[model samples]
Structure formats: C-alpha cells, structure tokens
Target: MAGFRWWFMAVLVVACWMKGVAGQARQQQAPAIWVFGDSLVESGNNNFLRSTARADFYPYGSDYYRGPTGRFSNARTFSDILGDWLGIAAPPPFSDPTAAGNRIMGGVNYASAAGGILDETGQHYGDRYSLNQQVVNFETTLSQLRTMMNPESLNQLLSNSIVVMVFGSNDYINNYLMPNIYATSRTYTPTAFANLLLNRYSRQIEALYSQGLRKFFLPGIGPLGCIPNQLATGQAPPGRCADSVNQMLGPFNEGLRGLVGQFNGGSHPGATFVYGNTYGVFGDILNNPGRYGFTVRDKACCGFGQGQITCVPLETPCFNHDQYVFWDAFHPTQAANGVLAQRAYSGTTNDCFPMNVQQLAQVRPM
Candidate 1:
C-alpha cells in the first residue's frame, strides 16, 4: 500500500504538470508575463531557495489563491491582479520545484519579499534575491525558452512579453532607516542616492532589454510613510503619513520616470515603457478610503500589536479585508491590488504616463 501511494503521488504530480502545459498551449497575443521585482508580486517563488524571506504558511493567502504559496501578501499580489487584467496566467515563481520551463510560457513571478533594486538594499532579510539575482533567474528561464521554441518563436514570445518591474521602497525603509544604520545613509545625500539607484536601474532594464523584454510596465513606490508598519515604527500621529520618508519617494520617482524616458527615446529605441502612477493611485485610495468603499485605511487587516507585528500563521486576520488598505506592515490587501491593477491596465495618462499597460501590450515594441 505504501509503495502504491508513492507511485500514485508521482503520477498525480506528472498529471498536474501536463495540465499546466496544456494551459500554456492556449493561443494568445502575449506569450508570457516575465515578472522580476520585489515582494509585491512574488508567489511562493522564494521557497526553492534557503531564504529567510519565505511566506508559504497560513494566513498569507487568506483572500484567495488557495493556501499560502509564499506570497508577501495575505491574498493576491499586484502581479496576480495585473495578470488577470491582461488575460494571462500570473507568472509562476521560478523558485517552485515544479516550475520546469515546460510549464511557464504564460509567465513567471520572480519577485521576492525583502528584495530591492540594489543588491545590498534588502540584505537584512538575510536571504532574498537581489534585483540582479532576479535578472539572472530570468536568464535561466530564457535558456529554457530557447530549448522549447524556435529562435523566431522565442523572440516573438519575448517581444510580446510584458515585463513588470516594481521596487524601491525597501531601499529606504529596510536599508537606510532600519536600526538607523547601513552605509548608504551616511554615504550619500538624497539626490546622490536617487541618482545611484537610477544609474543601477538603467543598467538593470538594459539587461532585460538584451533579454528581449520590450513592453515594460514599471510601477513606482507608493507612500511608504502611510503604511501601518512605518507609522507604528515611527509612532507618528494617528493616520498621518510620514512627511520625511514620504519626501524621499518624489526624487526617486522622478529619477525612475526620467530613466524610462531615456530608455524609450534613446538606448532601447522602440521599447514601450509605461510608468505606473503607483504613488498617485495609492495615495488617492489612502486619502479617500470611503470613496473606494472602505472604512479602514490606517491599520492592516491582519497582524498583532495593532499591525506593528505582521500576521503569523495562527493569528486571526480581520474579518474584512476589503475595508483595509494594508494586509500587513508593508503590503496591500488584495482588494487594493485589484483596484490598482484595474487602473494600471486602462487608466489614462494620469494613471500611467505615456501609455497604459493595455496600450503597451497592444502596440509593437520597436
């Protein structure tokens, strides 16, 4: 009976893998969502490594997508919602032992919790993939595509792929502020730091461009000062966003947008890069929760110490996720994610500068 059970399990795994392949066989304009970012889009992708940044436990996936699969959110992530809006499968995390190249033509999420644009920014997490490392992971996926499809087919797939890059918040919070330490805080002024990040960012996107990622949707950081964790950590006044920390994002965002403009008009000619107005969209939501059908915006839906501590597997989250903007100290509720995705997909110039995600997807990259 034991031997029979083991054999049955193997067969089931194989069956599931086959089913995944069939899904990828669907005829679609966009072949995949090759995502590479931070915790906002990760889905159990961190488990394959020995990283302390694992979230494959309970209460993490409370709102949807079955049990916790290492997503940094309590429910679906920004990538998940965006994938749904695009009518493509959310990229499987390359970290999944089962995510063989055969099952990932639709997309794969390589975002990791505690990850940052700079390799050393989120080192406090102990073992998270840096932005550079995530790009390396994409190379692994690219090699697989080379084997699975013809050269023309691979190029076609990649040219149409919507490569999403969401990062930057941790560089300030986790790196500069935490413990009031890290060399970055003392080494560079705000302008220098922003420039530093932008310089490295330009290189990173160029790496993606070399990999044939043409349609780029880069979401900037939201008001990190407004997050419950930031508030609690700083003991700021009730419901007030942090003024000092919030100020940092504007300069960084300017740098990011400028970088995108350069990529579109210069180095990567013909690439369609749309910068998601993440800060604006989320700021409006935070300011007018009632307008968005919410009652709570100050606290997280889950966690202890009134959200100072994030949710553990056994701790009970709030009964209403829709009412809260945050699910934990640093992440948003799936409800907020859905709203953000909708805006990013089709919202006008105010929501996505230059063009929206849908527009980027529909048009050809040079």
Candidate 2:
C-alpha cells in the first residue's frame, strides 16, 4: 500500500507539470496588439520626447486611473479602450525605458502626439515621430524580438498580432491647411494632396507587411471640421461645421477605403486590412448627440484661448466630461472614445469596412 501511494504522488506531480507547460505555451501564443498612430492613440510616448506637443499634465488625464499619464484624453485613448475589449494589456510606449528585453514580447506602442503620415506634416511641433519613424522603431523592436524567439516563432507571433494605426489628420490640420507654414497646399490641390498622402501611407503599410504583420486595423480620420478648433474659425454658418474642411477629407477617406480593398484583394498575402469608418461614426454622433448620450458636440470640454487651444496645464476641465464629445480642441473624451472603440471592435459593416476588429481577430493567417 505504501509503494502504491508513492507511485500515485509521482503521477500527480507529472500531470501538474504538464498542465503548467500547456498554460505557458498558450500565454506565449496569445495574440498581442501593436499600436502606431498620432495623438489619438499616443499613449505616453511623447513624454519621452522633447516635443511641445506633450500631454503629461493634469486635466489631460483627470479621469484616468493613473492620472495624467501623457494620454491626450481625459482618460483612456481609443487604442487603450480597444485593448481593454480585446483582453490585451496596453503595451508600453516604445520609447519607455522599461520597454525592453522579454517585456517587449507583450507588444509595443509607437504612437506619438503631433505625428502624421508625412515626415514634414507636423515638423512645426518639434520632435514628433512621423509614421515612417514609427515604422522604423517597430523594426527595431522586431530585431530585439528575434534575439529571444526563433525565426518561425517570431514570424508566427507577428503574423497573429493586431496592428492599430490612426494617422493623416495632422497632414491636413498642421500642414496643408496652414498654407503659410507648408508648401503642400500650394503644391497640390486637395485631390492631389490626398493622393500624395495615400501613396506615402501605402508605402508605410507595405513596409509593415514586409515585416510579417498580417492583421491591421486602420481607423480613418474623424471629422476635423466639426472639432472645436475648426468650429472656432467662424468659417462655417452658425450651428454648422466647416463644410469646406469636411469636403476636403472625403477624397482622403474614400482613397483610404480603396487602399484597404486593394490590400485585401491580393496586394499582400495573409493580410487582413480592416478600415474603421471614423468619419461616419463621429458624424453620426455629431448629428445625433442625444442618441449617444452626449449633450455638447460643437464645443470642447476643456479649452483655453479662442476655444481652439488645448487645455492649459493644471486648468480645470468640465465636470460632466461624459456629456461632452470633444475633450480639448481636437481629441475626444474617454466617454466618446469608449463608444468609438466599442463600435470598431464589434460593429457591423457601417462601422468598420469588410470586418470589425473582433472579426479580424478571429481570422487565421492565410
């Protein structure tokens, strides 16, 4: 009987060990989220840069649990909310000191405030990382990952990961629109400028694809015309948005949708490109604010001079942030971001073209 008891104990130990090994394998194989974008998804990367566009102050993160973590929103950004829905922890910014070694296997966010698709788009801001630079940083992450994971495992991890990219707004806001500061407006018409951006953006996407990234979620720029910054211009009729600015964005959004279709139509093997209809979603909210539980859509929850300026450091913001759509002159409040992230994660064709993030997450690599 004593001999039998010893054998049973040995069997139990081996079984427990096998269970732990399986759990570890599953954890390693879990899909991670790699984020790359501009201010809308900045996450705190700009804190590490010597940029004037930094947001590491109070009122910026008043509603966030960590309080002023460099996020441009009052709480979580769009990518942060989306990551919550996916059950994936938001990755540390690529520039963070701790984002190295084994910690990188979880993922990395390369988003920077004032960033844009074109390198020169937001140069006036000082020290912003362009989309090209973000991609380069991603390559560096891939290199470090290669040291820890075999080529096959690394490729598998990357191919299964979801990449979120939000850009192009700054190209219009900071570059083309500011004709005195940038020659792009003088050099090209709105259509031509859109084409130029799409061309550059296409190259960036292809570059990422070449690096084994297969699942991409690209959220199109929202209605900049409706933001407090543009509305304060007095360029529109009373109770209306800056229609001229909104018109200029149409071609860009259309071209972006075309790019998604092109990518999925055999431009890149095993690639699943999903386009989030940010314009449509935000427009719907603007047109029907009450439907989305928002009371103020035309103004910002926090502003300084001219109602277009961003929230001043340590300045007090509106108490009812959830009722307000715009957080500052440009970004959305956490409440609005939650709605946008929810729709992008699971909404139908009207929200995200082809498939939503939830659907894209389930698709196996071709």
Candidate 3:
C-alpha cells in the first residue's frame, strides 16, 4: 500500500506540470481584435482622401510609431493598448498589403477620420468618413479574412475577436455645438436631440451586433467643453471645467447605458457592451491636472491659440508636450490617451456605469 501511494503521488505531480505547460501555451495564442469607429481610429485612411482630416505629416506619429509612414498617433491608441494587454501586436492599418498575412492571425483598423454613423453626415459636413463607409470597410476586411482562412478558422477568429468603438463627439461638435442643421432644420431640443442621435447610434450598434460580434468596448463622451479649443471660445473658470458643454455629455452617456442595457436584455445574450466612460476619466484629469502631470490645461501643447499658430505649422511648432493635456484643442495627448485606456480596462468609473474596460473584455461568446 505504501509503494502504491508513492507512485500515485509522482504521477499526480507530472500531470500538474503538464497541465501548467498547456495553460501557458494557450496564453501565448493572442486574441485578434477588430477596431471600428471614427477619427480616433484613423490609421492614415484620410491621407488617401481629399480632406482636411489628413495626418500624414510630421509630429503626428513622431513620438512613438515614428516616421511619416506611421500617421496614427504617437505610440498607439486605445485599441493598441488593449491589444498589448492581450499579448498581441496592435492591428495593422487596413491599407497595408502586409495586413493580409497579419490579419488572419490578428485584427484590422477600420476607423476613418471625421467618420459618422450616417452616410449623409460626412457629405453635408465637408470631410468626415460616414459610419456607413466604415461598415463597408469592415465588411470588406471580413471578406478578406474569409479568403485567407477556412470557415472553421474564420469562425474561430470571430469567436475570439474583440471589437472597439469611440464616436458621437463629432456629431455634437459639427452639428449641435453651434446650433446649425441638427438643431434648426431638424428641430431638435437638447433632450430630443440626444434621443435622435442615440437612435441613430443604436441602429449602428445593432447592425454590428448582427454580424457575430459579441465583444464591444464603446467609449462615451469626454469633457468636451473643457477642451483647449472650446475653452478658447467659452468663459471658463480658473482651473475648472465649463458646465454647459460638459453637462451635455452626461445625458448622452446615460442614454448610451440605457441602450447597452437594452442590447444585453435582447436576443443577443452572447453580446457584451462595455461603456468607455471617457468623460469621467478626462474629468479626473481636469479636476486634478497636477496629479496627472499636466500644466497647460487651457491651451494645446502644439497649437497657437492666439492667432494662426497651429501645432503642425512651420512657424508654430510644439515646445513641451508633457505639460499639455491635449496635443491639439480637440484631442488628448498620448499620456492622456494611455490613462483613459487604463481607466477603460479597469472600469474605475468616476460617475458612470457598472462595467469598465476590464469587465467589457469578458463579453466574448462562450
């Protein structure tokens, strides 16, 4: 009996070691991610188009990705951060031909600069890529995936993939902020306007959900009114945020939470919606800029607010980027983006929802 017990213990130890090795191997298999959204996801698609949304120039991707070839931001965006956390390289830009080889095992960026949910929004506005076009791009990529891999492999890709989105601010800024088409011609009150915008957004979300996408990380609005550009125009308090514009984002976020609830309760039990509470994250930074290593809270780090001094212009180049929360009046600096990405994954809400970025990550199909 003693001899038999000793043999059994040795067998158990070897089995445990083998199981640990298998688990480590599985972890090495990184999950693929499909990024879909607005200018935030723009990986130089705008450079090809005849639009002012182009970023295929200097100082854009210089700090991180480097060289004019890397036009998407300095280091990487939220999607890249998430991909890193998952142990995979950030998805390559869709325009890259090498994407075919990488995408079969990884993901793609389908975001277009100035993109919107409706096709007509971009045409009426001047430059943005309408959300419809983004969807078209997404579908095209899906076809490419189909051509590259078998059905079983494709299904595996779909099953393990994550999709992220950050949008709606463009519509507010371009249409609602100054009281133009959406408010006057469309006749929308603030509350009604939010509802209408959300309705359009819901349609887009539903369409994506229909396409076998179960994991979603959707960002809510940030402190838009406090942006350097907006502050330049509004009467901002010293070291504090403006109420009128910042307040608007709350209702919008609330409406989004309600929408997520509806989606979760509907037929798509497999679908998980994680709300990116960017507003709270940005607010935290605004409320305590010093804590986050920010100094220039009112103006862009790279732009001249007084006159024609822009961040990228020949005469008006950036001096110190770390002091500024925004690289420009509208966009946050890479540091800010990194903080927001961390906050998204952690789900540490300042005053938003129960789900954070980390919670949202688990929204994949079983």
Candidate 4:
C-alpha cells in the first residue's frame, strides 16, 4: 500500500506539469505580450551571465518555479504574472535572440536585471545589463519572429500585442546615487538631474514608438525612499522616509505620464499609453502594511540589523514570508508582487486602484 501511494503521488505531480496552467491551452488565440525594461521583469537572464544580480542560486526560485531558473527574486515576477494572466508562458531571455521566436505561443520578457534607459555603458551597475542591449536583442528577436510567421500573422501579432516597460531604478540608485568608477562625479541638484533623466527617457520612448509598438504600459517608480538598504544607508529621521530621493522620482514619473497622455490623446494615435501607478500602490503598502497582512513593513526580512547583511536563505532565512513585504533589502517578496500585479492589470488609470491587467490587455495597437 505504501509503494502504491508513492506511485500515485508521482503520477499526480506528472499530471500537473503536463497540463496547461492559467488556461494557457484554452487561450491559444490571444496575442503575445512583449516585455521590456529592467530587473523588475527579469525572469532569469542573469543566470547565463557572470553577474552578481543573479538569482540562479538557491531560495530565489524555491517558492514559485520550484527550482532555480535564475530569477532574481524569491519566486515568480510581473513577467511571470503576465504570462499566467495571458494563459501562456512568460517571455524568454534577452541573451537568446532566438528565444522569442521559439516561444511563439506566448509573451516575451526582454527585461534584463540591472538594465536602464539612458545609460548605455552597462557600467552603472555591476553584473547588470543595459537597456540599449535589451532593445538590440529585441530587434534580433523580432527579425527571427518575422521569419517564423507569415506577413499577415506577423502583422496580427504586432497589432494585437501589448508592450510593458518598467525601469529607471538603476539610473537613480546606481548612477546618480552613488558615483561609480565610470562617472565624472559632478554634483547637480535633484531637479537638474531629474530633468536630464526625463530628456533621455523621452528619446527612448520615441524610439520604441517608431518600432511599431503601439500599446504601452509604463510603470512609474515605486516607494524608492522605503527600500531597506537605501533607508539604512541614507539619512532620514527615524520612521521617516528620505524625502529627497522620493522627490526626484516624481519628476521622472511626471515626464512619463505626460508622454503617455500625448500618445493616447494625440491625433496620430500610434500607441495607447497605460499608466501604472506603482508609487500609489507601494505607498499604500508602506503606510498601511496591515492592510496587506504584512508584519514587518519597515525592515527587510532577510537582511541583518536594519538590513545591512546578506538576506539569502542560508545567511538568514525569513520566518514568515506573507507577513513581510520585502524579500530582500532591494526587492519585494512574491506575495507583494502578486498584489502589485493584480493592481496593475485590473482597471483603468482613473480607477481608485490604478491600472490593472485587464486595462493593460485592452490597449489597442496602432
């Protein structure tokens, strides 16, 4: 009887793996979602690289995918969430230009961990990729896609698809915050620096629009002032956020919001911009963590006192995941991401909850 039970359990596991998840097989006719931007969307591209921003190690994927796929988080991310919502597999790695074509059945996550829009040098963050490289890789991926499908099919794919872009964390955190070896080390007021960033960001968005991408979901900065590492190192009153850091993010988000509105309300409507109020959602979580059923809202779960040391499982494992908002000093936990995803994909920008998954899907192509 014991042996029979063991065989039965094995069969059940195999069946789950074989079956389509989130209605993937049922929604075979839906269009693909093209993901772009930074580490927030990184499903596992860093595993192939020799970078420190890698999650291929243990405890990262132990929660969701069950094993290491090199994700830089404790479990599945927004990219994976989008896949589940779309009933298809998440996007493939940017390293493999042919990956998008291979996954032809689902969306593609072109986001690389540590990538940014304005910084093309790839030196801002160690072990992190650049935004330009992601776009370049995407061009190759698109060419491969063109080869795999008929002209009509390709056109349909582009027209019916959605593009999600989320970035700017590294630009502020790595380049502007701490002067890396490559920088000239100039001091400019936060306003000046933000203007510079916005200018560069505008150019990148324009470039994407020219590429026939008509549906855009651009997420603004989250609570940058609340991250454990930043708060621990930065000068702020006890229980108070670093107002200066959060201040800079507003201008950047404002510029993006204006651009989104321009495209959405313009005469030559080539793309529909869907604004993702990351700031609002993250702020809500921070101000009232109990609303989300979180216990430790101020400090990270894995890090040392006030989040100074390694927050990895071996170094210091968290006791209760759902009770904590942040998984590490830098990133949010899986449950937090799940809540964020639900908010991002559920309604119109005017909705009290901000943009949601359904609203993002409703973005009509140019």
Candidate 5:
C-alpha cells in the first residue's frame, strides 16, 4: 500500500505542473492593446499636457468608477469597453508617471484630446500630441520595454498585440473646416486634402510596422456634422445634420478603407489591418436611437447650451445620461460608446472590414 501511495503522489504532482504551464500559456496568448487617437479614446494623456482642450473636470466621468479620470466621455471610452471584452485591463496613459517597467506589458495609451493625424491640425488648442508625436512617444515606450525584455520576446509581444487608432475627425472639425484659423481649407480641396492625409497616415503606419508591430484596428471618423457643435452652426435645416460637413468625410473615409486594403495586400508580412466602419455604425445609431434604447439623439445631455458645447465645470448633468446619445458637443456618452464598441467587436463585415476585433484578437502572428 505504501508503494501505491507513492505512485499516486507522483501522478498528482505531474498533473498540477502541467496545469500551471497551460495556465501560463493562456495568459501569454492574451494580446496587449495599444490605443492612440483623439478625445474619443483619450484616457488621461491630455491631463498631462498643458492644453486648452481637456476634460479633467466634473460631469465628464460621472459614470466612471474612478470618477473624472480625465476621460472625455460621461464614463468609459470605446477603448475601455473593448478592453473589457478582451478580458485585458485598460492600459495606463503613456504620460502617467507610473506607466513604466512591467506595467507596460499590458499596453499603453498615447491618445490625447484634440489630437489629429496632421501635426498642425489642433495647434490652436496648444500642446496636443499629433499622430506623429504619439508614434514618437510609443517609440519611447518601446525603448523602455527593450530594456526589460529580449529582442525575440519583445518582437513576439508587439507582433501579436493590437494597435487601436481613431483619428481624422479633429483634422476636419478643428482644422480643414475652420477656414478662418487654418489654411488647409484654402490650400486643398476636399479630395486633395483626403489624399494628403492618407499620404502622411501611410508613412505613420509604416513607421509602426518597422518597429515590429503587426495587428492594427483603425476606426474611421464618425459623422461630425451630426454633433451638437456642428448642428448649432445652423448649416442644415431644422432637425437635420450639416450635409456639407458630412460630405467632406466621404472621400477621406473611402481613402482610409483603401489604405487598409493596400497594407493587407502589400509585402508587409504578418500585417493584419482591420478597418472599423465607425461612420456607418454611428450614423445608424443616430438615425435609429430608439433601437438602441436612447431617447435624445439630437442634443448633448450635460452642456449648458448649443453654444457652450462642453459641460460647465461642476455642473450637474442630466440624470438619464444613458438615454441621451451625445455627452457633450463633440463626444458621445458612455451608452453610445458601449453600443459602438459592441458592433466593432462582433459585428458583420459592414461594421468591421475583413474581420471584427474578436477575430483580430484571435489571429496569431506569423
């Protein structure tokens, strides 16, 4: 009986060891999320910047657990919701003092409020990180990571990881459309401007690829004309969106989609580019708010008036924030963000071309 007992103990030890190995493998398979963009996904990077465009005050994050963590939404941003679905913790902002060491293993958010693809897009706001600058910051994070991890291991980590980019809206809303302030409108036609943006954007993506990054989730610009800020301009008839403003987005979005195809079909090995149809999904939500359980789709829930699109600091927002679509002049409420994230994560090809985020997350790097 002693011999039998010894054999049983040995078997149990082997079983436990195998289980631990399997668990570790599963943990390693989870992809890290690196987020970059404008106010739509800006976690708290803008707070660290001396910029006029910031949302570090009350009523901004009223629904967030850590209230007012500088997220532009009334609660979580689209990246936050998508992270929950992936079972990965939201990455700390790259500018955060504590976002160093192994903390970056999960990912890093370089998004900033009022940021844009063009360097001069949001200059009036003062000290915003353009897409070029964000990539530069990411390079800094990569340097820190290399110090802790070997080359092969770091390459594997970045190749299998996902990079989320949401840009272009600010280039239009704050740059091209603002003819008085920016020369872009006067310098280029709508089509010419789209081509210019894409040319610069292609270089940025190539820079990321050169750094060993692979998977990319690029969400296109939404319908800015439908937002309260544009609506307040009275460019459109009553209860209608600014058609002229929205029309300008078409060429840019189309060219962006083309960029995805170009990257995927190119010589770039193991590169998986997914274009998210944020415009279609957001426009659908705006047109069919009742289908999404939203009551107010025209105006913002927190701001004082159509002119003052953003919330007044310490102002009490509406109790039924979830019922409204817009949280302020330019940003969506948590409810809208949740719906958008869901569609992008698991929706059809019309929502996310080639594949959804879930499928993108499952793809193994070659």
Candidate 6:
C-alpha cells in the first residue's frame, strides 16, 4: 500500500510540472496585451466618435497597414508594434465592430486621441474619452470577457494578463500650457500640478487593479516641450526646445516611479507595476538621432508648415519618414515609435524601472 501511494504521488508531481510548463509556454506565446491611454495608442477606438481629435483619415497610416486604422501616427503606433513583438495578433480597437465579439479575448485598445490623465484635460478636443471613461469602457469589456469564460478561468486569465497605461501629454499640451487659458498654471505650481496628475494616475491604476489586472506598464511622458508643436509655439531661442514644459514632466515621472514602487511593495498579491522611462529614452533619441539612424528629429514628416500643425488630409508627407522622428505635430513617426517600444519591452532598468514589459509579462508572483 505504501509503495502504491508513493508511485501515485510521483506521477501527480510529474503531471503538474508538465501542466505548469505548458501554461508557461502558452503565456509566452500569447500574453494578452490590454492597452488604455491617449493618442499615442488610439488605434481605431475613436473612429465612431464625432471628435476633432481623431486620426481616422488619409496620410495618417500611409507608412504601414491600411488607411486610417484610427492611429495618430503616419504608420504603426507603439502598441501595434508591441503586439507583434509579443507574438499576438494586434488587438482591434474597442470601438471597432470587429472587436465586438469573442475577438475581444485577444485584448482591446481603449485608448482615444486627446485622452489625458484628467477629465477636463481633453475636453477642448470635443468628445474625447477621459481616463475615467476609458476605465468604464474597460469594465464593459470585462463584462464581455466574463461571459466568454468561467469565473475562475477569467480571473486566472486577467491575473496573468498585462495592462498598459500611456497618457499625460494632453494634460499639459491642451490644458495647462494652452497659451491664454492659464487654468492649471494659475491654480497650481508645476510640482503641485504634477502631484495632482500623479494622484489621479494612482487612482487609475487602482481602478484597473480592482478589475483583476495584475501586470501594469505605465509609459512615462516624453519631452513634450521638444515636440514640433511646442517648439513652433514657444518663445524658445531658435533650435532650442521649450524647457518650461519639459521641466514639468520631471515631477510627473518621479511621482509615477514612486507610485509603481509603492504598489509593488504593497500587499497586493500578483501585482506588478513597471514604469517605462519614456522621458529619458525620448531625450536620448532627440540628443542622438544619428545613433538611431535618424537625420531630423525636430520637424514633422507629415504636417504642414514648420512644425506648426499636424498632417492634414491630402497634405504631403516627407519623402523619407524613416529619417525623421516626429510624424505629425505631436506623435512620433513609426521608426521612432519602434525604437521606443523596443526599449520599453526589454531595455535596461534605466529605461523600464522594476522591470521592462517583457519581464513584466513573464513574472509570476511567489
């Protein structure tokens, strides 16, 4: 009887190990990539909306894929490239009819153009979905996910899934520094305003966490002041970026880093929050364009005027987008976005604190 019991235990252990290895392989091959944010990742979500901030038009997606796709870039957005890297089919936008069914199991992009950390931040853009609204949208998707799988299975899937939040640019670009508005600037200092954004950001992360999201990747804001639009509008000496706006990003990124650390250090089991130092990575690209095979990191490859506006329909794009960084007035070209996404996924701790996105996907809580 003792010998029979021992044999049974050994078989059970081997079977469990095989199951675990199979699960790991499945996760490595197809970890769901849930994205929630703003223009940097809108995909096709904003297409159904009657918003001026949408990118569902010509010349916007000329570099890759079909027309529009509701992405703000001239080609594949960072998230699209990232999905490819992760070995999963690119997630359809939440608003895309194709994503209406069980196709959502592949993940979804709830990002909207002009969406920001604050509700009021993107209001001027007309019908832009705020971060809170994005969370609400996510909840709707979660309901659908629940219907598709058993509760236990759904919980396990969500626990193993990855959530990405990319925002903050519009909060500054359209809200605080919109020239005459002076709302945020007058009400709070840079540091104070950063705290406010960070506070809201914490809530956003917590909101997602409450939904069983376990892995999080928060991409920090890039150097907004150096973007073509800011450079064109600001009083910076020729060829110099608007330092004031860029300076504001520092406090926000610092706050984000701390927030991630806090979450990781807390008692939340299976929770992994990573901060991708996009600000630093972008700055590196700007400072050393040649290292990334770029000649022009300043001007927009698809916009009209000297970095004054974005790519308009029928308007001409640059002869070679690969040589430039900025695709429009605000977004990065596909080439630049590719570099940024690669870094966020697997770069050193300097680029993605705690861990990069790839590491975040593989981690299983002890």
Rank all candidate structures by their lDDT, best first, as comma-separated numbers.
2, 5, 6, 1, 4, 3
Q: Write the per-residue lDDT of candidate 4 for residues 140-258, one digit (tens) a residue.
A: 76787778888778776776677778888867766677665435126656667667766776676667666666666788878788887778975767888878778878877777677
Clashing pairs in 2: none
Report the C-alpha displacement of residue 187, candidate 3, in angstroms: 1.9
Q: Candidate 6 residues 91-129, lDDT tens each?
A: 888887768676888788999987888998867768877
Task: Decide which is better by lDDT, 3 or 4.
Answer: 4
Candidate 2, residues 1-366, lDDT tens digits: the string is: 999999999999999997874454344323699999999999888899889898899899998889998899999999987887776778899999999997788789999988999999888889988999999999999989988999999988999898999999999998998988999989999999999999999999999999999999998989999899998989988889999999999889999999999999987988899999999999999999999899988888888523878889989888899999999998999999988998998899999999998888888897
The per-prediction CA RMSD against the true structure, in angstroms, equals 9.0, 10.1, 9.9, 5.3, 9.5, 11.4
Error of 2 at 105 (Å): 1.7
Q: Would you list the clashing residue pairs of candidate 4?
A: 91-108, 91-109, 344-356, 345-356, 345-357, 345-358, 346-356, 346-357
Clashes by residue pair, model 1: 44-69, 91-107, 91-108, 91-109, 92-108
Which pairs of residues collide in candidate 3? Answer: 114-128, 115-129, 116-131, 302-311, 304-309, 344-357, 345-358, 347-356
Candidate 4: lDDT of 145? 76
Judged by TM-score relative to the true structure, which candidate is superior, 3 or 5?
Answer: 5
- In the predicted model 6, the residue pairs found to clash are none
Residue 357 CA displacement from its true place in model 1, Å: 0.3
Q: Please, what are the lDDT tens digits per residue for candidate 3 over residues 141-186?
A: 8887787789887776776677787777766666666554555225
Q: Residue 233, candidate 4: how far off, in angstroms? A: 0.8
Model 4 residue 258 lDDT? 71
Higher-lDDT candidate among 2 and 3? 2
| Candidates 2 and 6, the one with greater TM-score | 2
Q: Rank the candidates by TM-score, best first.
A: 5, 2, 6, 1, 4, 3
The estimated TM-scores of all candidates read 0.90, 0.91, 0.83, 0.85, 0.91, 0.90
- The residue-level lDDT of candidate 6 at 99 comes to 85
